[model samples]
Target: MPLFSNKFCPKKPTPRKVELSVLNKELGPEKALQDLGLEIGPIRLKLGDQESLFDNGEWLPETGPVSGTHKENHKLRQYVQQLEDENNLLKLKYEILLDMLTQTTAESHLQEKQMEQLQKQVLNSSRIPRTKR
Candidate 1:
């Protein structure tokens, strides 16, 4: 009987070892592997490696301002404006109400004076004392 069968044979052979130095120099190791669609978690460099190569090349110095912060500031300003408008409206309404109350009070006082004069005339004609004990 035959010990091996052709069914178990691999369709393609894979290379086990690769040249690291040439690959590292050509693609700077990080970019080369990324270009090939490889994902390596944070690359750790040896103490002897070049510091500039390890530093992130895409760092920005003055990131300026974030849009969210500006948006929040704008929203805060709008809210303050709304509150001020509400306060002004309430103040105007309060003044109108106060004026109405003052007019009502003055009218009530005039009515009270007229009623007192009518009562005095009725008492004088009927000869009755209007004094309260």
Candidate 2:
């Protein structure tokens, strides 16, 4: 009468937890976990009260740029500003190109009218009788 008969139940797989230090080392410290859709918070250990004895002498507390949400917000704001500046520059280029296109179109129409007028003048001159030379 075992709790899990080999035939009835398969063994549950153990869940593996990734350490923040490992992630930081692999992904660089500047990258925010939130960017990858992962939440950041304190790490919890599975051990009981006896785990206190294994604590390391050195404790590195979060501080300065690495400490809070402000850094992430700053990065996001800078990214947005860069995008806005790029958008504005593209818009300016588009306007300049449009103006050039408009000017070219106007010039082309003027040239066509001039050509038509020259053709009409040639036809009129040819139709007029000339003195024999």
Candidate 3:
């Protein structure tokens, strides 16, 4: 009998360690780590002659600051502010619509009551005796 047989082997397959380089190439370092349920760590990147590190979720160049980083940050802040403003505006509009709906519902109920009263008056008038003119 062979040493490695289906029946002789364990039911579950053994877990194997995957190389970080391979994982980076195939699924990117961040996504691979996330899929493996591992804690996120700084990523290292080699661009031409420079080696940069991505730490704290931000890219840090070994040489010097990259252009447009500040501009990007400003744009992001503006976008967040705009979204908040729009959200507040929507909330205000929703409250106004709710108030309008409540008023309309109350007016509708009042109109219905008025119609019922008019119907009752007409019925009562018809039942009363009238003298010939």
Candidate 4:
């Protein structure tokens, strides 16, 4: 029996039975973190004196009612309201600008009509018979 025989060689095996989660099925953890404006890094998890570090943190359960989340949400809401007010003001200004433009256009049309009438009158007068004086 040969020691280095073809039977001893490792065969090219197929993929094993591995399960993929829903999140993994979709746009991956890295993409999900990016969408949520978070950086990829190690996460610390504790389970009654047992601490573990994980590369992916999206799956980690939140610490529930985080004070930082509340503060951030409060600030976000305030900024949103401010932006809404600014948008309303911009809308009002846009309406005013549109009205002014419409009024100016109407006035220009009226002036053009008046000029046309004056030109017609001058032409008519020139064509009319006049006494030699």
Candidate 5:
């Protein structure tokens, strides 16, 4: 069955057995493999054997700046903090706007009521009958 693969990375047929082709080219000095604790290449066995071969290769050192991993982590942490700060600032601005809107609405309502009361007072005073001289 054909398997789906990324366009950038086409799938390759897994070799059942790996072989040593040239003396100096693909296969170097045999002692180098032994020193690295890698099983002799041109090897054949179950697929699981490949894992050990991969593990045997040299890895990053225990100390020193390793591939700027710490720097990346620091940048991520700072970014999260900055986002949080901006979110909080937005919330504060939203609350202030809401409060301003509430105050303006209340002021307008109070003015409307006062205007109605003044109109009623004026009408009542005019309706009062004046005594004839």
Candidate 6:
């Protein structure tokens, strides 16, 4: 607590100052900031006014308008080509699976017909009487 209020005194308030005496003296302010991963620099803030909005900050690409557009177009074309290649591969896989399914169905149907023929041959032989020799 103060002995007397500053309102009655003629002394003015001085600015506050800090000093890291013992443990932090070895690591200075810059080293401490680096250790904490803090950077002290002029940061580019998104301003509401058009003063530096159009100015090339870190967000804007350092390229001409036409070149940037061309680069975007090239990326889109590459993406489209990749998608087309994937579509063709999927179509090829679908055709191969369809052909395999068709072949399996045909083989199953043929096996069913063979089973019916064997059953008929057994029934016909049982109906006939065998002569004693």
Which is better, 1 or 2, measured by TM-score?
A: 2
Better of 3 and 4 by TM-score: 4
Q: Is candidate 4 or candidate 6 better by TM-score?
A: 4
Candidate 3: residue 36 lDDT (0-100): 86
The TM-score ranking, best first, is 4, 6, 2, 1, 3, 5
lDDT of 6 by residue, 21-76 (tens): 53368888778778855575553444343111123353433344544675687789
Better of 2 and 6 by lDDT: 6
Provide the global lDDT of candidate 5 against the true structure. 0.68
The lDDT for every candidate, in the order shown, is 0.72, 0.72, 0.82, 0.76, 0.68, 0.73
Task: Score residue 93 of candidate 3 by CA lDDT.
Answer: 100
Better of 5 and 6 by TM-score: 6
- Candidate 2's residue-wise lDDT over 16-125, tens digit each? 98687877887876674655656655443333332111225532333443335555766899999999999999999999999999999999999999999999999999
Clashing pairs in 2: none
- Model 5 — TM-score against the truth? 0.45
Clashes of 3: 0
- Predict model 3's lDDT versus the native: 0.82
Alpha-carbon TM-score of each model against the true structure:
0.47, 0.48, 0.47, 0.51, 0.45, 0.50
Per-model clash counts, in order, read 0, 0, 0, 0, 0, 0
Decreasing lDDT order of the candidates? 3, 4, 6, 1, 2, 5
Query: Which candidate wins on TM-score?
Result: 4
lDDT of 5 by residue, 5-124 (tens): 555876899978744354335557675466555664532223332211122453322234542675577689999999999999999999999999999999999999999999999999
In the predicted model 4, the residue pairs found to clash are none
Model 1, residue 133: C-alpha shift (Å): 37
**lDDT of model 1 at position 45:** 40
Cα deviation of 127 in candidate 2 (Å)? 1.2
| Deviation from truth (RMSD, Å), model 5 | 17.2
